[model samples]
Target chain A: MTDRQLKIIEIVKQSGPITSEQIATLLSVTRATLRPDLAILTMSGILDARPKVGYFYVGIDENNLIAKKLRSKKVEDLMSLPVVVGEEATVYDTIVTIFLEDTGSVFVTDGGFLTGVVSRKDLLKNAIGGIDINKIPVGIIMTRRPNIVMAFPDENISDVARKIIEHEVDSVPVVEHVKREDGKEGYKILGKISKINIARFFVELAGE
Target chain B: MTDRQLKIIEIVKQSGPITSEQIATLLSVTRATLRPDLAILTMSGILDARPKVGYFYVGIDENNLIAKKLRSKKVEDLMSLPVVVGEEATVYDTIVTIFLEDTGSVFVTDGGFLTGVVSRKDLLKNAIGGIDINKIPVGIIMTRRPNIVMAFPDENISDVARKIIEHEVDSVPVVEHVKREDGKEGYKILGKISKINIARFFVELAGE
Candidate 1:
């Protein structure tokens, strides 16, 4: 901040809700002289300008600043390539895919549209239940569509992080609505956001 | 920040390496009048003061401010109660306990000291690999001690979070060094830090 800007903040802090004209008079300068400084102060969120009332002191809040910056980050900026499988793939194949990709869950698609989600937990339960892993298709035991928590490319990282926590799921597929060949609405998988992503983001935030 | 502080920053930014007396002279104020403001600016990292020279403009870095706040959090402040089981517990029983507690992994202890960690992935892998889970003790399948990633109460959250991501593990046990009956070094599990905790913390930071 400049000395003039600092002086302007001091003026506002003491007599906030004071007009720009009054501040100019107190500083022995014209309103035009204080224009740029006032602009910088208010623009930086150090002061609030109310019509007919004047600029009010809105000192920098570090917590709110952090929150604002975090919210500014969108899902598209941090999402990773989604691990996906076809609905017709066997449960055993899905499990193999999961291990190969090292993902917590895999999205199931039918004709290239999301149909279900199968997590490690789900596969474990089925694996222990005496089910024929090689015979049963993943579509038979997966958490079917409309039940899966999903994300969009433009959604805020904070919002999606909340979904991951609230849903108690390791990850969610970032999807887009599309019309299937059967003329039904379906979601096309784009990316995935998981706890790992959030953790990495936390590391990134701290490192930066 | 106060107006005088802002003014001080401006003066330093424009004519830095200029002494305090010179700044006081330019502002038509006494050195005493600028002392508190200068102190605040320097303390907040907005200015760097040299012994012989005047204050230099360090400026406020929002990213660093966020990083400092994040690093300020310690593991003990955010860790959750660890889900533990004895080494004698069968894999089937451990799996049941995991479902009952809704945890991703369970710490295995022997004589009340951490011995190993068994994650859902390990159990699932064993479950589908034709093992008799009911007869196999979790100790046989767990990632044994000395190979486990562990945390301490005083470790920084950023450092632990980095460990979680780099190690590719779901969580790590917060342990304390202890002497066993035979005088062998052992770790007593105190808590666990997981992606869930980190995600929750991310929410808390963004919310606050």
Candidate 2:
């Protein structure tokens, strides 16, 4: 945060429940300059302001605020496009897919719908055996649907982090429910969220 | 940053060349409460203060601030313990070591000195080639030193981040020169800094 932001916080702590007009008068700044600062402070939960009342100190336990921010965040806020491979792709093809993407896992899809998931460990186990990698379809060995953990765009980010850590998986496909042409329900893969994304988010937060 | 902190920045921007006493009186806050905030703002380069003049606006563009912060941060601030394995350890053993530590890379050491580094990609590549995992030592395939990018404790974090991205490696081992019992010079492994560490540090900054 900037120095001005820090000072604003200190003032609120000392004199809040205080009004923006009072704050502006004291800081010798016009409401115009304080507008953005106040908006950011309130939006970030550093200050709580009421319509008729005024701005007030939100307390310090910034870690709590950060956790709350993460909890309320949606999957779409951080999701990245999933690296996918067709279900019919061969194990050798899957190896190429893994290397090309440089990812630990890939979603197996059939016509843009998620069907299963394959990871490096699964492919490595296959490669260690004497089987013909070129002839074996990855779908035959993938973790099939109904077993895969997923998130919708609107789901909480905290829940997504839980799924990744709990499942001991590198990435989770973010899928949305859609009606098929035949009137059947199916999931359309939109993106993926990995531990790296979470870490990056945390880094961004620290900068704030 | 808190609301008061934001106010301070605004005040400095609008009235800079303003004094601490004037800031304290305007905000009705004690000098004690404002002390730490000023120090952090100055230290982070968010505000430049002159001895008799006072604090002034440093401008927006937080990316610049964050980059500066990263560039000056020491490796010790971001380091974690190195996950190590003996140089003679077999590829199969290295696989087990990778799983146990759950790290993307491991340092190959001999007699407590750095030797080489191995990553998951290396092991996966080896596993896919149908090699004798049990008999082949990982040292044979490891990225040997002079090739391995490392950081000293005092090295800048931005430099570390650059090395990792440039080398396309997941992490860098932090090392320091030391004297051996036999009065010979050697290097000592101190810790490891990975992409995750960088992310976590960023998150912490946002919270502050």
Candidate 3:
């Protein structure tokens, strides 16, 4: 909605059962110009109007509005591609890929199948342990599948945000179920939902 | 200010030169109770008033309001303790320090004098190079002084935010000038400003 429409919603919310004439006067706009805004609001269930009683508020709870917006939004609307590396890739090469992508984590995959995930913390842990990064395969140190937190396209974005907070993880891979040639069920990585993404979304949609 | 006061500001911003009678009625409060809120707005220069014309909006440029808030705020108001490690400490120990603290970077200090900064990326680079983390001092691999992005207590938080964004680093160490025992000027580490801090500040202050 445009700023003007948002303003109209605020007006009706603060003082419902107010006549269009009164609202128009308060906004310094003509009734004809406000007609469209009123219609859109009424049609969208944000407002209710009567011939004699005029406009009344019928909007969602304003206090939890941001939370509601987040919950209603699907993950697919905001998911982005995940940084990935082959399972056979050495820890040294994985480090290069991570810095090159400028991400906190990368997915370890084997023949396009989801396998494991490695994060900056994981790499730091390995580095601190006096391990040979060049010789060790990243898959050996990665958080294996079944332990990795993930999300589906149809899941609520708010749930994804909760997962990030609860797990204290940077990102969760977006995945989908796939059937292997042998008929066993497996998952395929599609995208990721990062803390940065959620933070940015909250900033953009919460207030102005 | 309370959310109610914020709402009052929004009301005046959208439809300024509006009468107190209208605002009080819309907010479902008495004009007597709104007196304090009005006074605060007028005192803050966020609103201007006239005897007959009512209240008028006289605030910062709306487009740059958020940026202005961040710029005008002191780093001291938002800083958190810097995660630190001794300069003589091994890269292996630095890795342990980083993971234990759950921070992406740590300050390398020698006798309380600001020396260098070691980040996850730095450790990863060392790891990839097949260096002996347990033997190499972090000071040897750290981003030396004059290369590290820093903030002072008097510096703008917005400037710190910009540094993080421009440099693509996780955090900036907050530092201040101090006199050494030998009478030379030196820098002392105070705290840090991170991306999460900025994001939380934005959420708390904007549009609430």
Candidate 4:
């Protein structure tokens, strides 16, 4: 904004709804000279104009700008590397992978296709259920496909965020359809969009 | 944006750097009448004006607007009710409470003062460690005070988001300093700021 434009705002703020003629008089400029500045101020929602009352200081619509920026972002830009294990892997091994990867959950794949997901809570339930975690396959305790919430690369970050909240899961696997070696079609794990990613994104959005 | 303002933008976007006189000719209005609209378009950052040249379509600075809105929010406005348990509660019972409440972790309080936090991962390790979960207190395996990351009511959500990402914790207990029954000052659990809250907030911001 120019110095004169800012001054116009100040004058309007202090003595509005004051007429443009009075403002031009204070600035020693004709109404024609101040018309453009007034137009900018009112058009940007920084001031309100009435037929007889003149201009009133009105703030910008911050939420609209925020929403616009948020909507422009896609899930692919924010997802993190997914931790994966085979469906046949023992529950003990899967837990070890979770610790090694420092992830809240691990995706389970069969023939390199996503089949299920196992979380800390699920493993804890089984671990305390007196079962032999080393003897049973992780697939036995996992939340299987068709039930697992999934995300695509082009999906909106906001939509995936809603999925994470509604499903109450720490993360959702970003997947894409592919053909396995045996010619069966299934989703292949591409990445994982988790709360950590969302938190980090939030920090970045605020920081920027 | 007004119809004339949008029409002005379209003209600038298609034929800019076109002069105000040319734009006025295209719109069938006098140059003086188009001055305010051009001023509004340029001031709001929708168009760029260059002296001795003409206007150019310059999109809004979305990040700045998003950052402003994100920074305006405080943690207290987005936090969820924290699940709390006494230090004497059994690990098994704590796990039960976690399942019942569907929370990722529970705050452990001693004499109404926060003493520790026990997460699902913590319980999972102990549950599989061959310890008697039914006989041991949850405090025995919890992350104790002074080591726990915490949040206050007035903290910026973005700062807490950084803490959550840096600490790799699903949530942090929001606390307030209070005098216990024994006259000792300690933090009292108030609520929890979790990734879910962040995710939900993100959805709302985008939705709005």
Report how far off residue B122 is in candidate 1 (Å): 0.5
The superposed Cα distance between candidate 3 and the true structure at residue A75, in angstroms, equals: 4.7
> How would you order the candidates by DockQ, starting with the best?
4, 1, 2, 3
Query: What are the iRMS values of all candidates?
Result: 5.1, 8.6, 10.8, 1.7
| lDDT (tens digit, per residue) of candidate 3 on B64-142 | 3333334567889989889998889998888778878888789988888889998888887786576887899999999
Q: What is the Cα-based TM-score of model 2?
A: 0.61
List candidate 1 segments past 4 Å from native: A1-60, A180-184, B1-59, B180-184
Could you tell which candidate, 2 or 4, scores higher by lDDT? 4
Interface RMSD of 4: 1.7
Q: Higher lDDT: candidate 2 or 3?
A: 2
Q: Supply the TM-score of chain A against the true chain A for every candidate structure.
A: 0.71, 0.70, 0.71, 0.81
Candidate DockQ values, in order, are: 0.31, 0.09, 0.07, 0.65
User: What is the C-alpha lDDT profile of model 4 across B1-208, one tens digit per residue?
Assistant: 6779878987987898999999999999999999888877888778998998999999665676688678878988999999999999999999999999999999999988999999988888888787898999998999998999999999988889889888888899999998756779999788999888888888899884
Residue A168's C-alpha lDDT in candidate 2? 69
Instruction: For residues A41-73, write the lDDT of model 2, one tens digit per residue.
Output: 675566889987899988444444345455667
lDDT of 1 by residue, B1-208 (tens): 6677667777888999789999999889999998877766654457778888767987666786689789989999999999999999999999999899999999999988899999999998998888899999999999997899999999999999999998899999999998876988778899999999999999988893
Weakest lDDT window of 10 consecutive positions for candidate 2 chain B: B59-68
Residue pair clashes in candidate 3: none
Which is the better candidate, 1 or 4, if ranked by lDDT?
A: 1
Give the per-residue lDDT digits (tens) of candidate 4, residues A74-162: 98998999999998899999888878888898999988889999998898888878789999999999999999999999998888888
Task: List TM-scores of chain B, every candidate.
Answer: 0.72, 0.70, 0.70, 0.83
**2 versus 3: better DockQ goes to:** 2
Name the top DockQ candidate. Answer: 4
* Tens digits of lDDT, candidate 1, A105-143: 999998788889999999988988888999999999999
